[model samples]
Target: MILEIQNLHKVYNNGTHALKGVSFSVKEGEFLVVIGLSGSGKSTLLRSINRLIEPTSGTVRFLGKDITHIKGEELRKIKSQIGMVFQQFNLIKRRSVLSNVINGKLGSLGTFNSIIEKYSDEVYKEAYNCLDIVGIGDKAKVRSDSLSGGQQQRVAIARSLMQNPKLLLADEPVASLDPATSNSIMQYFERINKDFGTTVICNLHFLSLVRRYATRVIALKAGEIIYEGAPSDINEAWFKTIYGEEAEEVEIR
Candidate 1:
């Protein structure tokens, strides 16, 4: 297993319990997708793996190591193995795409650098290679703000790839794009998972998108996982079971 989330629980300061004893395992190179409505804790689950949103309790293991117990330098070392992408591109708007992508190497770089633009040639080559993988090698010199939403998201994906991550976590990665662009971005993820054997875990609200891209689907509602199975096994009945009253509110494509 590349990622093991065991008996995880998270309770926010505002008295909202985001996760409730959720446990799951992600094998290396697997493409797993999580589906849920807004505020259903899907993002929380993904972020918890990177400790971006610390779990209130329970252990998260990455390749048999307990990351939950590791802190400070040890934790930073463990984090460098994971890469995350968000719905928002999260790129430095004023920076060139190459500059933003190079930021991925900061975790591995020593304190000798005062500025990120001074990234070593080796890291620069890696960033360029990642851009090529994402079909955006030509955009390396372009400022991030000049790119479209899909292009910007691709830059975000490239940024994650620059990290040489063992695992990729995408939180609503296509929510901001049109259907065609969303499909294109999803295809990129699928290709990356197939070609590079990068374990991919993504959160999405579109059932159709999940069916199209995910090998496995996990559904969450009210901080609880209501369904976990292959994408083909998902149906209206399963959606009803998970969404209940909200089933009518859900508009599946």
Candidate 2:
């Protein structure tokens, strides 16, 4: 297994219980999609995996190492191997697309190099390659804010790729996008998972996209896992169970 979360729990400072004893394992190269209504802990769960949000309790083991509380350089080292893409395309808006992509490697590059913006030729080459993978190499010189939302998201994906992450965590990556743009963005993720054998854990709202892109599905409700199975197995009964009795499935495509 690439990642193991055993009895993970996260209670916020405001006394909100975001994740309640959540546990799961992810094998290498699996496209794992997390589905749930808002406030159901999907984002919390993903963020906890990468230590972006510290778990209140429980263990998070990555590649056999328990990283729940490791600190300093050890924590930094672990973070370098895990890439994160947020709902908002969190790019440096004023910077060039290439510059934003290169920033992904800042964790690996020492403070001096990052401060000086002294990226090596190899770094530039890798950034370009990542942009190419997402079908936006030509936009390297463009200002990040100048690109359309879909293109900006592509840059975000490329930025994460520069980390050379073994595990990529996407938190509602397509939530801000339109239906067609959402599918296009998801296809890029699929390509990355397939071509690079990267493990992906994505939080999504749309069952249509989940069924189409996910190799496996896990549903959360009230900060708990209500269902875990194949996308096809999430039948009508399971849908209502996950989303609630009054909920209706919304198709994106």
Candidate 3:
């Protein structure tokens, strides 16, 4: 297993218990999708894996190393091996696409050099290669905001790739795009997962997309895991269980 999470819990200052006692394991190279209703702690669970939102309790092991509470440079080293893509795309709108992608290496690049954007030739090449992997090498010099929503998300994926992460966490990556655009963006992630053998854990709203892209599916509700199985195994009864009886599954196709 590449990731092993045990009894993870998170509570906010407002007394909201986001994660009750989540536990799961991810094998290397699996495209794992997290499904849930709004406020189901899907985002919290993903963030906790990378320590973006520190878990209130429990343990996280990545590649057999405990990362539940590692600090300082130790954490940074681990972070460099994990990449995150967010719903908003999180690009510097005014910056060049190449600039945004190269920024993924900021953890490795010293603070002074990264802040000044004084990247070496090797760094530039790596950034360009990542953009190429996402099919945006030609857009390197363009400002990030000039691209369409799908394109911007692709840039975000490319940025994450510059970290050369073995694991990628995507939080509602295509939530803002149209269905067609969303599929295109997801295909890029598929390519990354297949070609590079990267383990992916993504939070998705649409079950259709989850079925299409995920090798394994995990459903969360009220901060607890309610379902864990193959995407094709989520039958009508299981769907209602995960989505609630009052809810209806809307087909994106």
- Winner by lDDT: 2
lDDT of 3 by residue, 1-253 (tens): 9999999999998999999999999999999999989899999999899988788999999999999999989999999999999999999999999999998998899988887778899999999999988888999999999999999999999999999999999999999999999998899899999999999999999999999999999999999999999999998998898888998888996
The list of candidate 3 runs beyond 4 A from truth reads none
**lDDT for every model?**
0.88, 0.94, 0.94
- Cα deviation at 59, candidate 2, in Å, is 0.6
**What are the root-mean-square deviations of the candidates from the true structure over C-alphas?**
1.7, 0.7, 0.9
Question: lDDT tens digits, residues 1-253, model 1?
Answer: 9989889999999989999998889899899999878999999999899988789999999999888766789888877889999999899999999999888777888766826346668888999999998899999999999999999999999988977889999999999998889889999999989999999999987778888889898899888888899998987788777667556633444
By TM-score, the candidates rank as 2, 3, 1
lDDT of 2 by residue, 103-183 (tens): 999889989988999889999999999999999999999999999999999999999999999999999999999999999
* lDDT, residue 147, model 1: 97
Clashing pairs in 3: none
Model 1 misplaced stretches (Cα beyond 4 Å): 114-116, 246-253
How does each model score on TM-score?
Answer: 0.95, 0.99, 0.98
- TM-score of predicted structure 2: 0.99
Model 3 lDDT-worst window of ten: 110-119
Q: How close is candidate 1 to the true structure, as a TM-score?
A: 0.95
Report lDDT (Cα) of residue 1, candidate 1.
91
